[model samples]
Target: MPVFLTIETTCDETAAALVTDQLEVLASVVASQDKLHQQYGGVVPEIASRAHVERILPVIHETVQRAGISLADIDAVAVAYTPGLAGSLLVGVTAAKTLALALGKPLIGINHLQAHIYACRMAAGRDVFPCVGLVISGGHTCLYRCRDPLDFELLGTTIDDAAGEAFDKVAVMLGLPYPGGPSIQKAAEKGDPHKYAFPRALLDDPNTLDFSFSGLKTAVRYAITGPGRHDPSQVKLSDQEVADLAASFQEAVVDCLVGKSFRALEITGFHRLCVGGGVAANKRLRTRLEEEAARRNVDLVIAPLKLCTDNAVMGAIAVEKWKAGVFDDLYLDAEPGVVRRSSALIHG
Candidate 1:
């Protein structure tokens, strides 16, 4: 079986993986930059790219070593090059291109969002195309109609801040830690989801699929500080107050995500739904999705907690392109922003 080397550095996580053509993950390694970014309350692009440069080689070396294989064993080199920070994407793309050229191997460029959806295919151990894919993360909150492993139609995307970005911002407002998804989830456990009644933007608009989390995030800020209040430093919140705010903010985000996702299903008529990304790992969101999927009788495939976050293993989606004989030249460059199709909102 042919083996592939996959690199992922779309964001703060630096990861590499070795996988067989049959989708068996022989070895996977990831180096996280959470501590580096934690103090900033969010990712600093320069810090992230620097970390990737420093960690990518070691990660790939460790993955190859763990797989008991030499660089010569790799038939192809795949790296996610689009829809991420420019510097971070360049680090991975440059490394992959160099390795591919050095090994005389084919270079495959992976779409970070599509790879997130492919994490479901990896988990299922079979084909999972022709489904609705929802990617919820710090950088993205969008829905796609997956026509195949590589073909995706953008159904809807965030008009402003993403769901996970809102989480991180809200966490900061509440004086919680960075990488807000987990921290907020922990604080929310003791609070009530219905306590504050945060706004669920665009939820009532049955005609449009685009999401707007900016308003919701602003609502959280206003709740913490009065309507005209700008600084949260003036307001001292108790443990219970903080927890309640966290729970309420999280609930609003989840409701918007779930509502829009199911709406995409209704519009696209896709029976199976695959969700992946950092926010997908939230316990409350997972439970809500599971319960709703059961009630709606929709097949829901969520990337396991281990796979939910950014990782090179998901880059195995390159296998599909490989079989199709699709490959990129060494001239491939990093695309920092999401290149969306001309089609905008999916109107019902």
Candidate 2:
């Protein structure tokens, strides 16, 4: 099987990976920017770009060495070219293009969202067709009707803040910590999700599969403070209060995902479900979704917690493009405001 050297610098992480056509990861390395972005409360594009420039080369070197191959053995250079910050995207694109040219190999540009779906398949070692892929991360919360590995149609998406973003914002409002998902999940382990009845937005939209987490996030904020969306200083949360809020917020997000995902399965007659993105790492979600899938006799494949977030091994998503002869040229440039535009909306 042909092997590709892949790179992903769409956001705060700088990653380089080597994957075979069989989806066997030879070596994958990620230089995370979590610490740098922690103080800022979120990913800052300028900082992300500079960090990528600094980390890309070293990460690539390490991955290739770990893979036990030199640039000469790689068949192509693959990179995420869409749906990412321009500065960060540029770093990956330029590096990929340069490698492709220097190595005299084909250049492949990939869609970041599509890669997330493909990741489920790679981790599961089976087709994720006829399923729904719920991508919940700081940057995105989209429901896709994945007809095939490469062919997907967007069924719904976030109209405002994403689920992961909601967690981050709520974390800040609660004075919890940065990178809200983990912190919230950790605290949620001790809280009661049913203790609070937070709202789930756009649950009844007649013609849209769109989601809105801004309201839920606001709800979390208001619960802790007297008034205002985010007045953490107004009220003090005992240890119990923090856990309860985290649990409640996590439950709200999970319920919304479960409702929407099951509907996608029922409507499309696709019993298999694929969950990806950072928030997919939530322990509650993994258990609940699996239970739901089992109850309905449907197959639900959730990636390992490690694969749930943005990492390089998942970059093997390019294997399909490589096999399909879908290659790019050296003229590729990066776009900071890359949005993973929906493929299409499918009813059935």
Candidate 3:
């Protein structure tokens, strides 16, 4: 089996993995910078890049060791080089390029967002193509028509803040932790999702698949701050109030996500839906999607919790390209913007 080394530093996680041509992950190692970025309430690019610089080599070393493979055994080097923070991406790209040059191996460039959807395929251990793919994370909330491992056509995208970003911002208002998905999920456990009828933005239009979370986020801000210059430190609420708000917000976000996803399936005439990205790890989102998928008779495949968030295991998506004999030049660069293409659908 042809084995490849994959590196992923698209964000705060310095991760590396070893995988075979058969999509079997032999070893995966990640060094999270959660503690470093926790105090900032969000990721600081400079800090993330610095952390990646410090941890990338060690992470790769551990992955190789765990895989029980020597440097000479790696057939190629794969790295997520697109759709991420430029600095963070540079660290991984540079490392991969150096390894490819030093070890005389091929370099494969992976799209971070595409890799997220590919996680579903890795977990399913089968072909999940020609399905609707949903990627929801702090930086991305978009739907795609994934025809193959490398072929993705954009169906819709968020016009404002991503769902995970809304969670983090609302968490900040509620004095929760930096990575708000889990925090809000924990707080919402005891609260009522129906306490407040939070707006499900852009759900009224059947023709549009795009998402809008900015208005909902604004509603939450006004509810807590009441149209004034707000100080997160000064905002105070009872534990119950906090929980209720969290529940309500989370419900709204989930409604938008699941609703739009099923709508995409209906429009595309696809029965299979694959979901990935960090927010895919949310317990509530997972449960709600599972229920909806069952009711609507749509097959749902979500990335495993460990693979939901950014990691090098997904970077093994490069294996697909490797099989296709796709390789990147040393001059490949990182793309910080969301990757998208014109809609493939045609209308009268």
Question: Which candidate's lDDT is highest?
Answer: 1
lDDT of 2 by residue, 225-310 (tens): 74544457567789999999889999999888887887777767788889889999998998899889989999888878887888
Off by over 4 Å in 1: 342-348
Q: Kindly report which residue stretches of model 2 are placed more than 4 angstroms away from their true locations once superposed.
A: 228-230, 336-348
Please provide TM-scores, in order, for all candidate models, with all chains considered together. Answer: 0.98, 0.95, 0.97
Better of 2 and 3 by TM-score: 3
Residue lDDT tens for model 3, 46-86: 99999999999999999989998898999999999988899
lDDT tens digits, residues 199-286, model 1? Answer: 8999989887788999988888898888987798579999999999999999999999999999999998889999999999999999
TM-score of predicted model 2? 0.95
- Report, for every candidate in turn, its global Cα lDDT versus the true structure: 0.93, 0.84, 0.90
Which of the two, 1 or 3, has more TM-score? 1
**Total clashing pairs in model 1:** 0
Highest TM-score: which candidate?
1
lDDT of 2: 0.84
